[model samples]
Every structure is written in C-alpha cells, then in structure tokens.
Target: MTSGYGHGLDRDRDPLRRYLSAWIGFSAGGHFSQALSVAIVLYAFSTQSVRALMGWPGSLAVLGTLVVLATLSLVGGRHHIEWHGILPVSLIALFGFMGLSVFWSEYTWATVGGVAYAVGFGALGIYLALGRDLVQVVRAFGDALRILLVVSLSLEVLSGLLIDQPIAFLGIQGNLAEGGPIQGISGTRNYLGFLATLAVITFAVEFLTRSVPRRQAVASGALALTALVFARSPATAIAVIVLIVAGVALNALRRAPESRRSLMQSVFAVIVVLGGALAYAGRSRLLDAVDATNDLSVRSLLWARIRELAAVHDIVGWGFVGQWPTEIFPYSTIIAPSGRPHETGLNAFFDIWLQLGLVGGLLLVVAGTLAFVRSWITASGHPIVAYVWPALVLVLIGVTAVAESFVLFEGTLMTFVAIATIAARKRSWRSRLPQAAGR
Candidate 1:
C-alpha cells in the first residue's frame, strides 16, 4: 500500500480520493490548520468581546465549535500524527486531578463543566503543538496577535478619538486620548498589556527566525510595544524586564562553547536565585518603583481573604471551577474592597489552591516547573531560532501568572498547554520508548 498521497491511484482519477486527500492535507498542516489555529487563538484571547457581544451562551457555543473542529482536525490528520508519548504526563496528572475534584465537589455540576471546558482547550492546544512545527505555531500566533492588537488599537481610536466616549459594552474607557491605561478589547489594561508583551516576544522571534519580512516583523514589534506602553500595567512592566534578562541569559547560554555551556547554566541559575532573593528583600521598593503599590494593596486584601477561605478546605480545595463561579457560596462571599465580586483569585497559584486544594496547587507547580525546565533546556541547546519562542513565552506567562490568573483561563491556558506539550515532545524521557503502532 502507498504511504502518502494518491493511495495508489492518481488523485485526479478519483474525485472522492482527491477530496479525501485534500481534507486530510488541510486538516493535517495545510492552510486550514493554520487558519484554524488563528481562529482558536483569536477566539481564546477575545473571549471578553465574545461574551460582551453574544452573551455566555453564544461564547460557549463558539468554544464548543472550536473544540469540535479541533477534534475533527486531529482525527482527520491522525495518520500524520506521532502518537507515542505525545502528551506530557505532568499535564495529564494535573487535569486528571481536576477531573477527580468532581467526585468531591459540592458543586458537582460546576466542576464537570469546568473540567470539560479546560479539556476542550487542552485538546486544541495539543493539536496545535502536535500538528504544526514550531515555526508554524509561531507564525499562527503572530498572525492572530497581529489581528487582535490591530483591532484593539482601532477600537481604542474609535472610542477615545472618534467618539470621545467610552464603549462600555467592550470596556473601552475612552482613555487613549489621555495617552492611556487603555484596556483595548481585553477588558482590562493588565490583560492588554500581557497580550501586548506576548506579541512583542512572538514578533521578535519571528524576526530572528526570518519567518517574515524584516520590515513587517519590526513594525509588528513596534505596534506591540506601543500597546504595552499605553496599557500601563505595572505587572507587565516587571514582566518585560524579566523577559529582557531571560533573553540575554538565553543568548549567552546558546552561544557558549559546548564544554562550558553547563557551567554557564549553573552560574546563571545562581545569579537568578540571588536576584530573586534581593528582589524579595526589596519588594516594597520594587513595587514603589513600578507604581504597583495600590494594585498590590488591593490584591493583598483579596489574597488574605482567599487564604483564610483556603484553610477551610486546604487539602482538596473548594473544587475545581476553572473560573470563579461568582454566584457560588465561598466565591460569592469573597468580594473586592470596591464591593465588586472577584472573578478570580488574581494569582493562578492562589486560584488553584482555593479551588483544587494544596494537592492540586502542587500539581500545577510541578507541571509549570517541568515545562519551563524542559523548554529552557531545549531552547539553549537547539540551533534553530524558532526553538527560543517557547522558552521565552513560558517566562512571560510565568511572570504574569504571579498577579493574574489569566493562566488558568482560555488564551493563556491554551498557550501554556501548547508550549508544555511542545517541550515535552522534544525532551521527554519517554521518547526513548519504542514508537507506538498508530495514533
């Protein structure tokens, strides 16, 4: 039998075969795959816009459709898939624990829905990581982010310049005319800043890899930086600084002689550890420098309340509702100082502990740590510039996760899953096992 294409007959001779071949190709890694990836990224990131425009049901419908399409795409492309040890065990354990929470959750229905929601996005992430090469993944990310950033800025212009009034539905405060703290379509300035930072990393990587024209990459990078500046997020400011340091460290490691690379890595690790200690010791000053004291003060209060609540169910947690179900008992009880219901625990670690318990929190930390370690190792050793994207992105996500639980939700969760899976596929010990027969 033939291994690929035609299946022994000329595709043109058999219309059904031609169509099937086209479908398979499209689903596997052709333009359809890329387009689907962009759609997923765009939808994941613009969830607020969807929710605002179409309501919860509509947003759920869109998510469900994307999941279904991702599944079909994976299945249709199954022959092209390398199924052996494709998923990271750490992620598997984490999600498995989330599913287990269903058995103990007071809100069983909510747990079920949350697990399903997370799994759907997880599946899409896996498809993205497995179906496309790293460069393709980066390109898809770049395309989606370009659209999001451009639209966000355009809307800001409309709200702040054209109409000179807030677009309340989309959360545009018409603040761009004042040089912004603009939220864009992300619903909050911090999230907009986070997305902008991601764009900058992705665009820079694209330029380094020569994936697109140098001019286009530079313009995209500039646009992302502009958004980051206008968003005025202190957390993002810190993340940008961390990213620059990580970038430099990675560059140095990659360029070191093979014999000294390991030693250099050790030195870098020591430096990072000492730097972290110093940062913590000077935390007050750092926060003041970033103008983040007010924000941290608010979060401190919220976190204190969450800690008290978490102690009530310290081991297993209130039970894994991915996003805080605001109407629920404990979550409903935890209101902000402004009398607004808190949507998340603000910190991903805190959110995990609150919902999934200490065990789940540990699992999350393990998963993230393993992913970062593996990606960092791969990036430092791999000659291709494309490999650096995952490592740097993990840094962005990890740093941002300190103050925002976006890592637990749609876009960020999906990206994390994809990066984790990609790194695992490259460096997993299980790769030594004999290949499985079929996907």
Candidate 2:
C-alpha cells in the first residue's frame, strides 16, 4: 500500500511538471514575441513615409488585435472551449451588446474593434476559470514573466547598440513633454515602471524557486534597465516606488525578522545598481530630450474631453474607440505637436464609460476590478506573481484612465482576463480540499 501511494504521488508530480513546463514556455515565447510585434507596429506608425500611406489608421492596436483574435479563434479554439465553464455569464452578455452597438456607432470600425476585444478577453477569462490548474498556471506565468524581463532587457541593449541612444528603448521622442520613449516591447515610460515592477515580482519568484546566483545577476541586470526611465517618467517612477514599498511592507508583515534579511539585502542590491545607473544617465544630454511629447498633462485634456463627450452621448455611449468632438471637445487642452499626444487616450475608465454608457461602464469597472483583485490574491502566494504583475499593471493603467483608455485592443484584454479566470478557478480548487479534521 505504501509503495502504491508513493507511485501515485510520482505520477501526479510528473503531470504537474509537464504542465508547468509547457505553460512557462508558452508564456515566455508570447512575451518576447509581443515585444517584437510592438516594435514593428511602432516603427511602422512613426516613420513619416509610412504615416503618409497609413493615414493615422485610427488605433493600429485595435486592428492588430482583430487580426490576433481571428488567428487565435482558430488555434485557440480548443483552449477556449475548455474554458467555457469557468467564465462569468454577465461579461459574455456585455460583449454581445458591444458587438451589436457597432451598427449604431458613428465609428463603426472602432465599435467592431471594441466588441471584438471584449469578446476576446471574455474568452480568456473563461479559460483561466475552468480550463487550467491554478498552481501550475501561476508557476508557468512566473517562468514566462522572468523570460519577458530578459527579453525586454535584451531589446533595450539591442536598441542602444542600434540607436546608441540611452533610454531610446522606451521609444520616447526625447522631448521634455514626452517624458519617455515609446519602445513597444519595453512600453512607454510609465509602462516601463510597470515592467520594472514585474521584474521585482520575478525576483521574488526567483528567490522562492531557489534560483542560482547567475539567475539573480540576470534579474539585477533587468531591474537596471528601468534606471533611465526613473528620472524621466515621474508617473512610472512613482508607481514603481510605491509598489516596491508596498511589496516590502507586505513582506515585512508576512515574514520573520531573520527571514526578511535576505529579501532586504537583495532589494538593496537592486536599488544600488539601478540608482547608480539613473544618476549616471541623469547627467547625460539624453535626459533633456523628453520635452516634445504630452505624457504628463495629456490626461487633463483627455479628461476634459471625456466629460464633454460623455455629456451629450452620456446615455447610449459612443461605441468603443469612437471619436470625440475635437473642436468643442478641448483639443487644445492636449499638449503636443498640434495633435500628437504621447498617449492620447489618457484614461480608460472614461473611455469605457463614453463608449459603453454609465450603466455598462459601471458594470465593467466592478467586474474588471473584481477579477483583477481576486486574481492577485489567488496568485500572490504562488509562483506566477511575475506575469501577474503585468496584468495588475494594466489595472493600474486602467485606474489612471478614469479620465481616459487602455489596451482595450482586442486580444490583449482577453489575455489578462483569461489569467484572472484561471486565478479564480484555482482559488475554488484550493477551497475544495478538506481541512485536516479541525481548523
């Protein structure tokens, strides 16, 4: 009997390992590939020659999202089917309504894109909820996020070598008003802060997994990549700082004095390396090149527009990604090259409200926040906090959008929601186990 029990344990362990390995591989490949995809998109839009031909294209992310979702529909079908049981019914209905809204919306393409995006994310939520095991899913997510940090760092290095511009990986136009570059894989400056926070989470996972010194060194290197952005993007820097402080405080509360020592030491080392890099970068002329873009004040203008836009079309909403009245809508409120705002849609919640109406928008907020917070709690103690950080970062980005929009791009929203669903599913699974006799 003892021998049979031990063998059963081994059998279960093997399947778990296999699942974890596959999940990690998929996540890592997806992360790096996403970076490459972003670079291609940015390079296409930024070039003057291309711009003349593309004619603004009105949210390339949305188009790209449609293409990705369509592709995933075929390849991801099996995965989607597997997740159907776990997804929330209300989200599905909302997406249906969004799709229907396209018929009446002035911006048909935007409406189509919005509905498609909502559907894609809704699908992912289902997958996370019913199709996968939570612990394995998170472990895989951690592994993948760690790889993403490496990929992001690699791109930064590559960009530096190619462009010879410090902080150019951020893709910032180097204008004081710009705050930071818009490197796709690395993301915008504030996005970089989100990325760095992921790195921090990765470091935590690495420690949890008992990684070697070499891995630690790699993570340290990744953290240093954000040094350039820290000085340039107050938003990103502030967010990163706050998260770091929060993480530390949380750990202090959770850990014993002696156990906390190692984490503190590791964190201090990261700060030293990243801080030194920032000090050096701050002195360079490159630091002054962030003025042309409208990152900092763009949100104010966007907020004003949202309020104005919402007032007239307040009830029915304006369809997803629909246009606002630029003339009476406070176009001048935006800071940029006549029309170039670093990130035009400064707020996401407002965008949703404007497009979906007050009732729909409120429901989405409640549902989305619930999903995010629930996922964070379910996955926090697990190994997936690394990848989960990016989703959470999206949540933070969404918060800022209370006045403005976010990755409402088709499959992106679904991707994170899918993660949330998986987290929620895992929580339920854990709850099913019987406690040992007494509490």
Candidate 3:
C-alpha cells in the first residue's frame, strides 16, 4: 500500500521511510499505540478502579495518558489537517463548544479538562482517518479488543467459577447470587454487551476481508457471541442485530444505480423526519404502550427526570463537563427528589441537551448526524474496499447511539476515534497512492 501523501516507504534503505514506518507503526496501534490510552481508561472504568482510587494523586493516570496521546497524535503530525470537511469541523465545533462552556460552567476546572480530553481524542481520530486505511484502523481496534476481552473473561471466570465470589473493587458481580447479572471486568452487563457488539462487528469486517486465518475469525466470532449472550443487555443485543441488518442494507445500497441511491436516501430521510415528528407528537401514548408509567423502566424514568433537569437550565445548560457531581447543587438537589441515580443521559442527544442546553445540543446532533449521513452517502458509491468499512462502522455507531453515549463523552474515547475515522474523507492509500508517489 502507498502513502496518501507522495512518498516512498522503502524502509530497507531510506532512513526517512524507516522513520515514517516506525512513527505510524506505534502511533497507529500496538502495545505503545495511541489506543493504549483508551484501553487503560476503559479498564479503569470497567473495574471501577478510578472510584476506588479517588483522592489519590495518580487517580486519573489513565485519563491523563489519553489526553497526552490525543494531543500528541494531532500536534505530532507534520502536515496540518484540512479542517474544512464535515468530520473535522463537526468535531472541532463539538469540542470547541464544550471548551467555551468553561466560561459559564459551574465546574470550571472539570470543564476545561473535559474540553482538552475531547479535542485530544478528536485529534487522534483525525490522524487515524487521514493517515491510515480502514483496514489498518480496524486491525488496531481488533488488537486492543482481544486483550480487553481476554482480561474480561479471565476476571469473570475468577469471580464466578474459581473464587465463587464477587470482586467488589473490580466490579465483577460473578455468576453467583442466582439470576444476578454478570458484569465481568466491565462496569455493567450492558457495557460488556456493548464491547462484545463492537467486537463481533470488527470480526465480521475482518472476516469479509479475509485478512485473518479462518480459525482465528471463527474463534473471535465465538468469543464475541458468547460474551453478548451472557451480557443480558437488551440495548446491546439490539445494537448488534441492527448492525448486521444495516451491513446487508449497505451492501444493497452499494449495488444500486448511482442516481437512484440519492433519491432513495432523500425519500428515507423524509420518512424518518415525518416518523420522528409523529413519534414526538404521540410520545405520551407511546410511553403508555410500554407501561412505563407504572413499571418505570430505566430509560423511561431517566428521560422523565432529564426533562425536568433540562428545563431548569433551558437555554445554556448546567454544564458541559463530566457527570453532575452527586454532591453538587442541581445534581444533589435533584437525586433524592427524582428517586433515580443521576448518572448519564443514557441517550447521547438527551445527554448533550442536559449538558449544553437546547442550542448547543441541537448543534451537536445536527453536526454528528450530518457527518454520519455524509459518510453513508460516500460509502454507497465508493468501491467495496472503502465503502463496506465506513458503512458498517458508521451504521453500528449510529444505531448504538440510541442506547449508548458513544459520542461526546470522555469514557467513549475509542468510539470517538472510530466515528472520526469513518466520518473522515477516506482514500485507498493502502496501495496505489503511496506506490505512485514512490515512482
């Protein structure tokens, strides 16, 4: 494969080639890869280690690493990123808004750090997209996921079968307690499911590409499926299923005539807008249908409280930093009254509104959706080499957004990377471009 920028990669002789190769090799992925930062943070969150280490000077070590990596990935690049595209601009705007929010945010220090975190991750994402091919990025994710899943499974086994006890520090609930949910090394069953969903999709793409041996593919698929089944998260289950369906749909879309595809997309967009309007208009009736009033499902009740919280800070939101601290004003004041843990918005869009208010939140939604849709359109026409990758990743991320805060959150650093890469202007730099430059 060739470099997108005109350059020879004949590392056997050229010192410059060797340097570029080494730079990208570590920066793109592996043990010392930029992804390491993300892995450490997820591990901390999964094991609830951060909470345990609260007040310690090195508590945010993982997050600190993440920020450094993100910043380095962007600032380390010799070539300036072209920020005109939807992918770059949306990310800049999203993080930029959060940065600006520091002026008005109650938690000023947290907001400032949060902005740096967002942009830092955003920077890494831009590098990944602009510098590498879809296959390489997927491989990096696959490598990281393998280690995570292995660690997670080991923890589950230790807690459930071997030790026959929950590991409170690691948040492993174990398989005991008769009908209890299995959290493994993840924070919750749903989070495990979420990771597994991403794994299966990654494995699927690798399988389609035939990049790995058949046995390895089969093993990874089996592993992901096993984890998903054990997770018991309805949302994660729906996400994986939707990913498969969307993949098949993208395949069909790619095969369609070029002109007709745009027409089809337009019609679908119209239908979606109308359906959303209808749904909003009859939301009360829809909520009743789910028996949410009496049962108060997790999402149902969370939404109910979110509305009230959002109303209190109608225009500019309470803050755009981290979670509403349990001890803080609006959060502490509302928790007992609402009767539900004021954790996350559960829905990405709702959460943004909770943090950034109506205007900022709407900007976040519009920018992100436009970027996703633009990627979708680009994938519809590009050759399968480019198209299938973004199509699958974008759809998976987009579908999963309904139930997961896969964007606009620090914990979702990896998701941000994936989203940025897929949404960036892509190229087949894997072969022709670099070779052309060499010649």
Candidate 4:
C-alpha cells in the first residue's frame, strides 16, 4: 500500500515537471522567439489600426500579451542575456524621473497610467535588444514593416478605388486615386511617410546584409518609395534628405583609415552644426520649397501657446502624460486653428518640456545624444552592414521629432528604447568591467 501511494505521487509530479519542461523548451526555441519579436514589432507599428479595429481595451490586451510572452522568452533564454551592462543608465534615469513626477502631478492617476504605458513599451524594447541579435532584429523589423506597408496600400486601394470613399474608421482618406496625400494605416500622411522612411532604411539594410533575397529587398524598397511619394509629407522629405547625407558620411567614415576616422567624425559634426544653422536661417525659403508654410503657420500658433503654458511649470513639468490627455486642464485649452483639440505639441522637444519639464527634457536629450554617438561609432568601426540600421534609424527619429512628437509614444518610443539599448550594449564603458568582459 505504501509503495503504491509513492508511485501515484511520483506520477502526479512527473506530469507537472514534464509540462514545465515543455513550456521552457517551446519558449526557448529559436523560431518561437523570432516570431514573438516580429509580432511585437508588428503590433507596435500597427497600434493605431489595432486601436481603431479593436478599441483601447483590446489593444491594451494585445500589448499585455506581447509583454507576457516576451518575459517568458527572456526567462527561458536567461543564459543568453548579459546582465552586467544590458541597459543604459540614462534610460533608467529618465524613466525614474518620470515615475517620480507622480508626487507633483495634479492628475496623479493619469500620470500613473502614463508612466505604466511608457514603461511597458520600454520593457518590450529592452526585450528585443537583449533577446535577439542586431541582424535578427533588423530582419524582424523588415518582416513587420513589409506586412504593414502591404496592408496599408491594399486598404488604400480598396477605399480609394473600389469603394470610392474614405475608410473613416481607420482614418484612411481614400486619396490614393486622387494622387494622395494618403493616410495609409498610420492615420495621417506624415505618419505614413515616417513609417515608409523607416521601412526604406530597414529594407536597404536587409538588402545590404543579404538577410533577405535581393528581389524581395528591391521590391520592398520600391513599395516603401511608393508609399513615401503618395504620403507627400514635407517633414519626411526633409528626413530622407538627412538620411541620404548621413548614409554617405557613414559609408565614407567606415572606409577611412582607423586613425583618421576620429578626425572625420569631428569634421562631420561641425558640418552638421553649420548645416543646421544655415537651414534655420533659410527657414522661410525651406518652408516654401517644401510647401510646408501653412503647416508651419499652424505649428507656430500651437508652439507659442505651449511656450506660454509651459512657463507655468518650467521645472518638473505638469506631469508625464505620453500622449496628451486632451480632456485635462491646459491640454484642453490648447486647441488647433482647425478647432480640433491638439493631441500632441507637434514638436517633441516642446512636448517634453510641456509634459515632463526641463529635467525630463534634458534627460531625453542626453539619452538620445548618447545613443546616436555610440551607434555611430559602432557602425563606423563594425564591418557588418546590419550595424548601420540603428544609426540611420536614430537620424530619422531625431529629424522627425523636430516636427512631430511621435518619438514620445507608442511605436517610435519603443524603437528608440530598443536602439538605445542595443547601442549601449555595444559601446557602453561598463562593458569593460570584469563581469561583462566575456559578454
């Protein structure tokens, strides 16, 4: 009787142990982890569509699910993670400041929610950086962008050609037939253009690295260019010009002798500074050249109001709301000329100042600057074509942030976190410590 009872207990324990082992194996599988990474990217980029189709509750559910899966994968693959120098201290500082803002926030609950949202995406970004190789991350981005762009174009064709009406639900204007200014799945032409620009970079990297077939890369590039042309966003057009110049500079630097590369970098920095000054001085002409004069007029009005209001909370900020809680005080008062309540401050820097104050704004600057510098250096020295992707993506983000506040929320925020993490992992000084030496 005693032996039978012991055997029964053993059988019960075996089933539980087997189940745990299977879950660990599944989560640790290469294919499973790669698919999850792609899914996270896809969901991040398609957040607008997800919200539109499934509502906030549904979208949040999806985000939560991805976070859970990512956590599981990381745990299962714990052996691969280099914990010594994984995350940049700058990022932690910024996030910690955001959390601390809860004390001073008038809208405490909103700030709490906002911080949670920001951290959720930040965690997902960390997962991508730590869990996959840089090349694998690029390929995942390529796959996700390909699917998103194709769907965006197909939806445009359906609404603009077949139905001859807007898909108001998805914010698609059905303007493809009208020689768009199309809004694809991103809800605005500028956003679509931005995504297309990112896709162009990713697809190019994919081609350069031979991560995907040549024909596929060429076709993807063509598709991205098509989306960009139709989107007709002056901001994105400017970003593309900057991207081309940066790409040329990076290529040149990469080919230069190692000793001279430092001098070349300094020269490029001076040129960039001078170019920015010249662009500012020629602002009127530049605006006219891009047909963004009207857009500028609208933005100037909003920015003026933001400056006035931001002066009220110039230090710590009103709170850490990522996307503006337009229903609240101050934010509610900043209406666009079109009578619509403004959702963002239009400029990311201004938005940060208004929301998180100068402290948060400075933190952001430090984080972004460090990330770019590290990525640029890594790309210049590394032979792999894949390293170029992070640097170029940062350029796009920095340029676009001047006119749009997308970097502070959702997909752009997540991308920034991932790239920053990757750059830190590669170039952080902490990596030299004995604990991190092998990693």
Candidate 1, TM-score vs. the true structure?
Answer: 0.93
Task: List TM-score per model, in order.
Answer: 0.93, 0.57, 0.76, 0.96
Q: Give, for candidate 1, the lowest lDDT window spanning 10 residues.
A: 1-10
lDDT, candidates in the order shown: 0.91, 0.48, 0.63, 0.93
TM value for model 3 = 0.76
**Best candidate, TM-score:** 4
Candidate 2 matches the true fold with a TM-score of 0.57
* Candidate 2: 10-residue stretch with minimal lDDT: 40-49
Positional deviation of residue 345's Cα in model 4 after best superposition, in angstroms: 1.0
Write down the RMSD of all candidates, one decimal each: 5.4, 13.0, 8.7, 2.4
lDDT of 3 by residue, 1-439 (tens): 4573334434445886577567654554434543554354344334344555463335456556655654445444535454333255566566667777888888787677666656655555655565445676666666566667777777787788888888887777887334345676666776777778777877777787776787888898888877777776666655665566566667777788987887877876686578668866985675565333332366666777778988977777877765445665555644533575566666777777877898777777666666577567776787754346655665666655676665665435445555555665543123344567799
Error of 2 at 314 (Å): 1.0
Q: Write the per-residue lDDT of candidate 1 for residues 118-174, one digit (tens) a residue.
A: 887888888889878899999999999999999999999999999999999999999
Report the candidate with higher lDDT, 1 versus 4. 4
The residue-level lDDT of candidate 2 at 162 comes to 54
Put down candidate 2 lDDT per residue, 2-98, tens digits, no spaces: 9999999999999998876564445334443344333323332223222333544643454455345434432433444443234444455556657
Q: 369-418, model 4: which lDDT tens digit per residue?
A: 99999999999989898999999999999999999999998899999999
Question: Which stretches of candidate 4 lie above 4 Å from their native place?
Answer: 1-17, 435-439
